[model samples]
Target: MNLRVPTAWFLSGNRSDSNYTVGVNNTVVGFQESEDLRIAHDVITNSILVLIILGMGCGITLDQFKLHLRRPTGVAIGLLSQTVVLPFASFALAHSLGLETEAAVGMMVMGVTPCGMMSTVFSYWVDGDVSLSFTISILSTLLAFGTIPLNLLIYSGSWTDKQFVIPYSSILVLVGMTTMPLLLGIFIRWRLPKVASVILKIGSYAGILLVALSLVMLSVLYPFMYWASWKIYIAAISYPYISFMFGYVVSALFKMENFRRRTIALETGMQNFTLCFAILEASFSHVTSDVMSVFPLLYGVNVRTAGFVFVGIYKFMEKYGPKPVLTEEAHHLKHANNHRESFRLEDQQTSKGFLDSEAAEENGES
Candidate 1:
């Protein structure tokens, strides 16, 4: 049964004027900015990117990455699903749903880009395998640089009212900007574990705060994608959820452990929107650019927000739920993290006591 119906039944929208506008006039969407403003937004976004990179650096542990590598089956399966399955599924959905030309291509790009950093938090919140989620997110992001072009070549051939090209030079810029930062963080941690540990502990909240500030300040500077239409939004919101559900449900069918399933679910759901958005921002010289604009603005925001809510709901039920599906690997990992956290607390207490005692002794002598 073809389930396609008036999308309005489930979603909200009007289908007119999906194009760029000008002077608060034509509904067509384009960047309306003085060169100076454009430069400012770029500088500000880059600044935020730097903070995210450093924050991720502080958080990443090479040892955790190693453990992820050790479980080749999980990692391999996840990479395969993320790199191959999700993109194809998204392509199919776009075709069947008759997603707008730009939107379809955008979905393809997003599907292949990556599981995101946010998935790690969602994984933890849901009692999922944080390790597996991180591994998939990193590996998938790396793979997209290669596979996105292939997706364009294969799936995009039919959508050819216009030609789409990804400049290798631009892609190289993106990879360098995104991954190099994370890798640099890894290096810093290795070179100075003590310093890195302190950074990692507070990095998440601090980093997010910085980006939020940057985004607000730059909102006027950067012309936001105008997606006031219903048709455009339908494509934006539905695509991510469809792809995510495909991964989430399919992973469960394999009867994988609950934690693994949950991790797979969230990893498939979230994506590195910042990276995809950057690619779009750089390459937004075509109709595909419109797709790029809409997807990240709509798809990324909705999915991550929904993902976080799901994570929170799961967190509330965590202790109340059935016993965990901690495979031996995850069980050992949980124990290790607990032990490390315990020792950290103990060390802090001991250090404080020693300081207090020394101060008391000095006072007595005085």
Candidate 2:
């Protein structure tokens, strides 16, 4: 979508500096009430989510997923990191920081949710195992159906007074939204490889577009939100890095390979904001939902920025670090060249021998 909503909201002569308040009521009041925000949230989030899912499917293959399907260790570790370790970390961080209830709940929701598509994007760029990333993402998403509601019940008891119910319909929407496009992309890859390749290139750019779209949506949704509080920023900055390290260290402890470690790290660190938003919309009143959304929106931006930093570091290392070994095809080509050189040497020796024999015969005749 365009930035017209935010621009119009800005130009409508309703701008007030005092509207930026720290209270949850003040921060999210405009968002809950704005028709523009509701529309933008639905349109922008869904579109971006679909594109991300499609891109993820385009990059992965059935062959690459064989290990996850069989052994399930990587998927198990990844799910544990996200569902168990990350959520506990999120709760601990938020509680220790003494954040407001809504903010704390937001962090927990982000921690409990599935990994975002941006993780897969980062994995691809950083030369991690894309298949492993996708596998972990899908498996975590499937498991979130159970773990998310359970987490909400467990962590939200102190935060929310209202009865929390798991909204199965919204969960189903998340499943369909994520899985359908993924399956379609996989089908295209299997059947129409050329088409899938083109789509995959386009999908790589989805991250940038989603970021821009989110900024616009947030601008329109909460034109007066005071995001300047150091508390939220502290949580945002610390959470992703902690989650990354947690995944990496745990994977290493479990004897995962380097590439899988990187993939798991990214997958664990990134949370699916769109899915979290959807759940918020389904489970709470507009006011409460809007208040909760601030956490995910801010977290999404910060985490992706960190992810890109990871990508840049990896690109630099790939360019300047030790070079990769030759592939099987390269080895075959080298062997063929050596064989050709040997045959040429043999021909030259035979020609010299024939010339010597001719010279000797001629001398004998003389």
Candidate 3:
């Protein structure tokens, strides 16, 4: 009744020869004795990654970019929390928890990846700053090419025994996958708004389908025991909540409004897990890839659970709690409306007074 699962059962072909390695001198090496199924799997996964990026880009617009940039404080804080704080948090957690090499590296990868659309959706649910959420999502993704490699180089090396050269080619492919589709999506949004909407829907649904297929594949290939480790569960469950708290604290310390604070917190907590999965699958051996994949899978589930809990609490409070106070902008708008109404009444009285005086003069003269 041994529950421990071997990687060979999941991945076809011999595990020993399937290791894809880069030399210390940054040489790119091919997979030895690679099977066609593995190659096809890689291609499909990368394609799905591209589509997901495209869908994300489609959700953004130049207007959002300009709006957030005009007031850059919130955006700056968000990027700092995302690229700097989250990675540091993950690195610390992995080391603190004493995760093994694959899990540690997985945690690092999850940290460095950009925020996903789920953050935006969760922001909306929790009455967060949705505009700011969109801005952070797009900007973080655009900057991911540079930030991801830098973060990986800075943190991932320590977790592994081998020299982890920066994966320039894979990153370049990521850049192309991210940038080109993003720009195309933006252009479609600008030129053909209707078409872009369709693309967005298609991309989202297709991406979900592909990810579901991948999970099914993983479940079928890798047994339940592969994911039964206590370390993985602890790291996955705590990671998002820790990230959420850090994001809130950082934004609150900067004196951000509550909505924006919530937005940043969600953005920081929810990492783009699909992208992380794709990177690990491409970069590591089948065994390592399979092992690392567990972190994101578990993380994705737990993060969503945290999001739902937050949303539920928010709804409960909104329903039963005290009436919410007006925000600064709303207060100003209310004051402006009241002032305008007073001016309108004064103008009407003045006109009436002038007409009455003229009528009296005319009557007297008559």
Candidate 4:
């Protein structure tokens, strides 16, 4: 395989020495990419991906799915954010930052991918609507077949060369792999609730493990020079929060409840970087894939960190924040309780008076 340095290296004025030394500001970073290492990474990561999707599938039920279909506003808004708003935001960010062709394409790819299971986890942690989160997650993953290619067709032209081909076949394979496990999980949930519960637990742990492993592998495999780039770092750190903000704002604008807004925000922000990795691996050159991979790795770390912070803040507020006022139903219930207590007190007083009068009458008769 011919190894061509990514255009990002040239744009940043960095050069590769004969020994593949990547340098910036007199700092040297070096790493060798072997086929075996790539194969190992792919196998491990893909397994984790399957487990994560399966776990998420187990969380869904036909009832919850049909309920969302009946009330489609929240789901529709979430889909809009995931499919439309996110890609446009990424494209604008890339252009405004004046990123190189490869890096820009990476941004768009991350944007267009479906929402990850981590968002459902985050929604649960933050007191968001977990059911809505699950609903959006499965729906977005199923719809990714069309949305991924459509977004790429619309946005890739501005960032990619004419020779760049959209890997429709690879995309189809990915969609199939993701959906089949998800459907299987749903089946398990429907037929064997106990087994689905176990799988859900396993999947949650696997998802956390996947994040840790990805970070570690990225640090070891990718050159330090890529991490040192301020442009990529800024883009990665900002992308999730920006996407999150957009989701919240749009949902709020549509008058969604707080829990639904929170769910949508997390779904919008925490994208399936695993899917992005698979796409890059299958579609791009090795060198370019390596270069673009850095963005998602950095993004995965930052998004998780920010999500934890948000969860912490939400928990704190929920525990110590101002109490919400009673609703009409609660108010009526409270009033009824008070009235019942008053009636009990009156009955006790009347019984006491009658007993006193009866005792006087007995004394007079004696």
lDDT string for model 1 (249-295, tens) is: 77777666767777887777776665565555455554335434555
- In the order shown, the candidates' Cα RMSDs to the true structure are 12.0, 14.8, 13.6, 14.5
Clashing pairs in 2: none
Worst 10 residues of 1 by lDDT: 1-10
Give the per-residue Cα lDDT of candidate 2 at 230. 70
Pairs that collide in candidate 1 are 13-230, 19-28, 19-29, 20-28, 20-29, 21-28, 21-29
| Winning candidate number (lDDT) | 4
TM-score of each: 0.68, 0.75, 0.63, 0.74
Model 2 has how many clashing residue pairs?
A: 0
> By TM-score, how accurate is candidate 3?
0.63
Two-way TM-score contest, 2 vs 3, winner: 2
Model 3: per-residue Cα lDDT at residue 51:
75
lDDT of 2 at 205: 78
Worst 10 residues of 2 by lDDT: 1-10
TM-score of 2: 0.75
Query: Best by TM-score, which number?
Result: 2
The predicted structure with the larger lDDT, 2 or 4, is: 4
lDDT (0 to 1) per candidate:
0.58, 0.68, 0.66, 0.71
